[model samples]
Every structure is written in C-alpha cells, then in structure tokens.
Target: MQWKQNLNHWLHHLPENDPLKIELENYQSDDKLMEDCFYKELEFGTGGMRGIMGPGTNRINLYTVRKAAYGLSQYIKDQGQEAMARGVAISYDTRHLSKEFALEVAKTVGAEGIQVYVFDKYRPTPLLSFAVRHLNTYAGVMITASHNPPEYNGLKMYGEDGAQLPPDAADVIIDYMNEVKTELLIEVAEVKQLEKDRLLTYIGKNEDIAYIHSLDSIKLNDSANNKDLSIVFTALHGTATETVQEAFLAFGFTKVKYVYEQCGPDPNFTTVKSPNPEEADAFTLAIQYGKGNNADIILATDPDADRLGVAVKDEKGEYVLLTGNQIGSIIIHYLLEQKLEAGTLPKNGVVMKTIVTTELARAITGTYGLETMDTLTGFKFIAEKIQEFEQTQDHTFLFGFEESYGFLIDGFVRDKDAVQAAVFIAEAAAYYKAQGKSLFDVLNDLFEEFGYYIEETHSITLEGKDGAEQIERIMESFWSNPPLHIGGIQVVEIEDYMTSIATELPSGMKSPIDLPKANVLKYKLEDDSWICIRPSGTEPKIKFYFGVKGKTAEIARNKLRKLKKLLLQGVHV
Candidate 1:
C-alpha cells in the first residue's frame, strides 16, 4: 500500500478520543505533520520503547502501552502455567501517566491469568528490578523515560533474573508486539476483578524498607565517622528525595539538606530544562542550596532514580559537578581501598564498565589486583554480567557502572540503583571527611595516580524517521571507510562490536571480541585517546563518545577537543 493510503486508513480507524487523531485532525492540511505522525510505528529498540506521549501507532500512549503489555502477557503465557503463576512486577516513576500505563500493563498481564505485583505508589527503576528478584517474578516492567524531557515517556522490561531482557528474549517480545493487530481489542482484566482474584498485588512500604536495608549493606567502611560534614541533595523533582534523605541519615550524616523547591515529584520537572542530573544546569538549584548550607558535597538523581550525579566543593570553594567518569573513578578507588584495607577484597573480584566509560576505572582496578571488563554502552550488559557471576564463577561482583551516570554496587538489584549509589557515595564522603579531605580532593588524588583521564559525550538529535536513516548511514560510512587517525594520533586498534572483531591497525591482525554483538564502532588511538559511535537506543539521537588520557588535565582537554572536532567531521558526511 502507498504510505499515504496506509496513513489514511489509520486516521479513519483511529478512535475519536485518540490524541494522535485529534492532533491529526488539526493538521489535516499540513501533509508534513500528518506524515510525521503516521510515517511508521515508533521504533522499539534494545532499551525498550520511548517516544513523545500521544495516541497513535507511532506514539507512546494508552493503546501502544496496552499492545506492548499484551505482547508481554502472551510471552509469559507461552512460557507455560508455571511462569504465569510466578507473576510479573511492575513499577513506575513520576512521569506523566506513568502510573496509568503501569496499571494498564498489570491489567493486560492479569487477563492472561498471570499474577501481577504493582507498586502502590511511585518508585525508582532499581526498586522494580529488586522487586522482580525479591518476589521471584517471571519478568519486570518499569514505566519511565529515564532523563528524557516531559514530553517523552518509555517502558522497560526485565527478565526473570532481574536484568533487562537480553537481546534474544527482547526479540521474542518484539515479535509478539508487532503481531498485535488492534489496540482496542487488547485483552485486559478489569482492575477490580484482578484485585478480587488476588492476582493483582499492590507492593507497599515494606518493599521500600527491604530495599533501604539492602543499600545499608553497601557500606564497606562503617568505622569512618564524619557526622559533622554538611551535604546537600536534590532529586531533580523526581522520586528519590525521600529515599535519599533517609539513606543519608541512616549513614549517620546529620547535616544533609534537601533542595526544597525540587524536593517533591514534579512530572513536568518545572524548574530544570532537563531532569537529567548529568548536566550541570540540572543542579543549579541544588548548587545554590549547597552553597547556602556550606555543603561539602551535592548529589542529584534523574527522574527514574536509576542514575546518580554529584558535585563537590573544590579547593576554590566552588561547587563543581563531576562527570560520570570522574564519579565512577572515585567510587572505584574508595570501594577498593576500603575493601582491601578490611581484607575483604576478593582475589577474583571483578568490575564492569561500558566501552565508552573512562579507562581510568580499569587503571584503578589494576592497582588492587582486580579485573575490569568492558561491555557495550548500556547497564543491561553490566546486569547480565552480575547474573553470569551468580550462576557460574567464584568471582565476586564488587561494582558495576556505565558512563551515563548509572552505577550498581550490590547485586540485590540487577539494574543501576541510584538509591544504593547515594548511600555509598555519602559513606565515601564520610570516609573522606574523617580524614579531613573533601570528595574533590579524593578525585584529584585519583587523577594524579591514574593520569588525567577525561571523557565527553556529544549527542546529535535527529527527529522523525529520516533522522534514524541518517544515523544508520553515518554509522555505515565510518565502518566502510574507517579512520586511519583521529586528532593526528595513530589509530592503533579498531573494535567493530557488530562483527565481533578487533583489528590491530598497525599489524592488521584481527581477534574476536569477547562481548555480545552491538551496533557500535570504536577507534583506539595510539596516544591513549579513543572515539566511539553508537545510536541512542531510547531516543532519536546518535552519540559520539571521546576519551583521552594525559599527564595533565589541560592536555587531556585539548586532545578531547581535537577528537570531538574529528568525530563531528566524520558524522557530517
């Protein structure tokens, strides 16, 4: 069928209450707007699905949510009665309509005769991961868009082991979702009926208590007490405020202050341009609060509370927001130091990071006779490794982190736990304070020891269907005509994860990559600089990551700037 004809069919068939149809009605004369809305179904990538909130086959709304849930329900039922009995756990952040979508998912799965454990109120993404394992659910679902804007929302699924469904499992779910024909006909058990049947359970405060207790176990250096140290925290108007504040108090920090303006859950994230803690602008209000309170440290979490971001008072008394790489390095150094000192550092201990993360973590890992493994740029692979460790090997999983503000310490939850991270980071701060040092001081010491390793992520947002094709074309262009050098540095090695091949530029020799296949390309430069290109799994954006190491911070910054220019140039063509 012609594209316009297919669109017209959907338009005519769309329900009157459908937001997409309503918007389309207003745009009837605007062919471009109509085409954009009906161009294609929103792409469901490995990170689950995310898009602008609306009603359409190509948007994230009630109908699409129901279809995805129906697909998940079918997948569970196909696994047999035992899987259905085991049930599914569902949670949601404070995004618009997040709770409604989560309840809809529960109803859809309930109609399949599967049990459902739905959180009674807003919760963090990691808690959903924890609930999956704690309740022994067959799968888990979290309705969140992570740090995306207010207009965006998403759905993420996790397998029985509490990790995001691996590619093979995700493919199966995607197939079933695509096969779903009509959203209106999607089967969903009435909420009251499911509740009466005892098939829909509402998770409550007890789970939160258990989760916080698990976070308490993450403290490796309890003997170091620094109750006098002042700190400020912000949830960026999301769901972490109460939990983080409580965790800090539990860790014996008495001077913690919350950013009042952004303390409560605000779906619109009214104050900040973006709810993402990774950006310095997101912490503006928190910084002001920190300065006023004489805070030695500042912490912020994204909307879903899965990723953590921090700032510390430098020697100049200015609040400086640390990059994800810098925070990861500090955490690694602190954890290893305390563990080794306490003689609890495992001989077979391992740490996991993404390919785009700073190599400083690897350098720090080596100092304590520990090993660091690299995965693609997602926390799921790190979660996969934690599961791998529990099932096989004796290697103790000490910590896992990604370059994008996500970190995990204890394996109680498979995904990143900012609540847990906040606890440990507070403990780390207390540990430093006991020695009369600030987190900034500790970070500087780490840089001095591991060389100044700096990393930056540049993302290019391309909207609509054409943007996706452009991203693919750009990636293919790099693969077909690989760079010989970047920023005048020799390309020593190229790792093509899609082909599972790592080729040595100098020797022209290739070796198999030990990790799972991904649509990523990395160029390792001779001067310890690297560039990687990968499309964002949850948004219409392509990311260019650059990491450079130098004897000094200025040199590292310079190298990163040159590499950034080269990367932009490569993507432009």
Candidate 2:
C-alpha cells in the first residue's frame, strides 16, 4: 500500500474520541504536517519506542501503546504460563498521557491473563526497575521519554532482572510487535474487571519505601555527618523531586533546598527549554535557588530521574556545571576511597563503564585494585555486567556509569538511579565540606592524581527519514575510507565495533574485541587521544565522542578542539 493510504487507514481507524486524531483533524489541510506525522511507524530501538505524541502509527498514541503492551504480553506468554503468572510492573513519568498509557498497558497485559502492578502516580525510571525486582515480576514497563521534549513520549520494557530487556529479548518483543496487524485487535480487559480479578494491582507508597531504602545503601560514609552543609536539588519539572528529597533527608542531609519552579511533576516542563539535566540551561532555576540559599552543591535529575547532572561552586565561587565524566570520576574515586578506608571495599569488586565514557573512571578504579569493564553505551549493558557477575563470577559489583549522565552505584536497581546518586553525592559533598574542599577542588585533586583527561560529546541531529539515511551513509564512509591521521596526529589503531576487530595501524595486526557488536567506530591517536562515532539509539542524531589526555588541561583541550574539527570534517565528507 502507498504510505498515504496506509496513514489514512490508520487515522480513520483511530477512535473518534482519540485526542491525537482530533489534533490531526485540525491539520488535515496541511500536507506537510500530515506527511510528517504518517511517514513511518515510530521505530522501537534498544531503548524502546519514543516519538512525537500524535495520531497514526508513526506517533505515540493509545493505539501504538496498546500494541506494544499486547506484544509484550504475547512475548511473556510464549515464555510460558509461569512467566506470565509472574506478570509485569507498570510505571509512568510526568509526560502527557503517561497515566493513561500506564493504565492501558495494565489492561492490555491483564487481558492476556497476566497480572499487572501499576503505579498509582508518577515515578522515576529507576523506581520501575526496583519495582520489577521488588515484586518479582516477569517484566516491567515505564512510560517516559526520559528527557525528551514535552511533545514526545515513550515506553521502555525491563526484564525480570530489573534491567532494560537485553537485545536478544528485545528482538523477540519487536517481532511480536510487528506481528500485530491492527490496533483494534489488541485485547484489553476492562479496568474494573481486571481489578476485580486481582490482575491489576495499584502500587503506591510501598514501592516508594522499598526503593528509598535501597537508595540508603548508597551512602559510603555515614560518619561524614556535616549536616550543616547546604545543598539544592531540582527535578527539572519531572517525576524525581519527592523521592530525591526524601532520600537526602533520610541520609541525614539537614540543609537541602529544592527549586520551587522545577520541583513538581509538570508535564509541560515549563521552566526549562529542555527537561534534560545534561544541558546547562536545565539547571538555571536550581542555580538561582542554590545561590539564594547559599547552597554548597546543586544537583539536577532529568525527567525520569535515571541521569543526574551536578553543579558545584568553583574556586571563584561561581557555580559551574560538571561534565558527566567529571562527576562519574569524582563519585567513583570518592566511593572507592571511603570504602577502602572503612575496610569495606570488596576484594573482587568490578566497576563497569561504557566504551565512550571517560577513561578517568578506569584510572580511578585501577588505583583501587578494582577491575573496570567497558560495555556499549546504554546502561542496560552495565546492568548486564551486574547480572553476569551475579551468575558466574565472584566479582562484587561496586559501581557502573556511562558518560551520558547515567550512573548505577549499587546493583539493587539495574538502571541508573538519580535518587540513589543524589543521596551519595550529598554525602560526598558533606564529606568534602568537612575537609574544607568543594567538589570542584576534589575534581582538581583527582586530575592531579589520575592525569588530565578531558572528554567532550558532540551531536549532529538529522531529523526525519532522510536524515537517518544520511547518518548511515556517513558511518559507511568512515568504514570504507578510514582516516590515517586526525588533527595531524598519527592514528595508532582503529576499532570497528560492528566487525569486532581492533586493527593496529603500524603493525597491521587485528584482534577481536570481546564485546557485543554495535555500529560504532573508534580511532585511537598516537598521543593517547581518541574519537568515537555512533548513531544515537533513541534520537535522530549521530554523536561523536572525543577523549584527549595530556600533561596539562590546556594541552588536552587544544588537542580535543583540533580532533573535533577533524572529526566533523570527516563526518561531513
């Protein structure tokens, strides 16, 4: 069928009361808007389905959501009735229709004779992970787009292990979803009937309590009782405020302030241009609150509270946002040092980081005699490492982090938990404050010890179907015509992750990389600098990650700038 015809079919099939359909109807005369909305079905990648919220299969609506739930239900049933009986947990964030989507998933799964544990209100992504494990559910669903714009929404699935479903399982779920021909056939038990049958359970404070208790275990030094230290936290108008606040208080942080404008679960995220904490603008309100309160530290969590961003007063008393790498290094160093001092550091402990993350984490972990492993960019891979350790190795999992503001300190929750990170960061701040040093000062100390390693991430967004094709072409261009030099520095090695081959340039020796195959390429420079390129899994963007290490910060920054320009030139060609 033609794309337009298929789109029309989908639009007409939508329920009359569907808000998305109504919105589309209002734009019926606009050809461009219609084409954009119905160009393709929203791609469900490793992170699950995320797209604009509107009518049509290309958007995130009640129909697409139900189809995903039905597909998940089918997958669980195929795993056997026992797995289905184990059921699924459902949670939602502060996005539009999040609650409605959660209920729809519950009803759809309930119709398959599988139980559903649905949160009664908004919750963080990590809380959903915790709920999956706490309830011993077969699977979990979270309705959130993380830090995406308010126009966007998404659904993520978690395995019984409380991590996002691994690729192998995700493939099966996607296959089942594709098998769904029509949303009309997606079965859904009546909400009332599902409740009567006890298949749909509304979870509330109990799950929150369990999650918070798990967060308390993140505190490394209970004796760092500098309760007078002031701190400010902001949720960026998302779902994290209450849990983060409670966790801080429970951890004995006496002076915690919240940015009033961004504290609540506002779906619109009105105060910030974007809900993502990765951007400095997202922390503006928090900075204001922090400065007004004379706070020593400011922390912000993205919409779903899976990633954390931090700002600390610099030497000049100006609040500066720390890169994700800086924060990860600080936390890893702090946790290891404190644990070792207390004689509680695990002897066979392991720390995991993404391949694109800062090597500073590896440096710190090695100094502490802990093994550091690198995985693909997503936190699921880190979670996979934790499960691997649990099943086979004696390695006690200590910490895991990615360069993209995601960190998982303890394995209690498989994914990153900003709630847990907030507690530990607060404790670390207090500990440092007791020594008359700020986080910024401690970061410099880390650099002094571990060498100056600087990392930067640049993303080029190419929207729509054509942009996706261009991204593929750019990646292929790199693979076919590999660069011999970057920023006039000799290329030492080239790692083609898709082919699992690491080729040493000078010797022409190739070795296999013992990691999952991903569409990523890394170029190692002679000066120990490197650049990596990978298309974003969830967004319409191609990202370049640059890491440069030098004797001084200035040298590293200069090398990084040159390397970035070279990389951009390569991508453009």
lDDT tens digits by residue: candidate 2, 1-573: 455786678677777886766787788898766776677777887658898888777788888899888878988999998898889999999989999999999989999899899998999999999999999999999999999999999999999999999988888888988888877568688999998999988899999888888776777767446587798989888899889877877788878888888888789989999998899999888888888999999999999999999999998999999998998888898898988999999889888899999998888888877888899889999998899889987889988888899988888999998888877877888898988899999999988887899999999999877788899999999999999987578999999999999999989999999988999999998898888999999888999999999788898888888888877875672
Q: Which residue pairs show collisions in model 1?
A: none
Per-model TM-score on C-alpha atoms? 0.97, 0.97
Superposed by TM-score, candidate 1 places the C-alpha of residue 375 at a distance from the truth, in angstroms, of: 0.9
lDDT scores in order: 0.87, 0.88
CA RMSD, predictions in order: 1.5, 1.4
Residue lDDT tens for model 1, 418-459: 988887887888888888899999988988888999999999
Candidate 1: clashing residue pairs, number? 0
Clashing pairs in 2: none
Among these predictions, the greatest lDDT belongs to 2
- C-alpha positional error of residue 557 in candidate 1 after TM-score superposition, expressed in Å: 1.5
Q: Compared to the true structure, candidate 2 yields what TM-score?
A: 0.97
Residue-pair clashes, model 2? 0
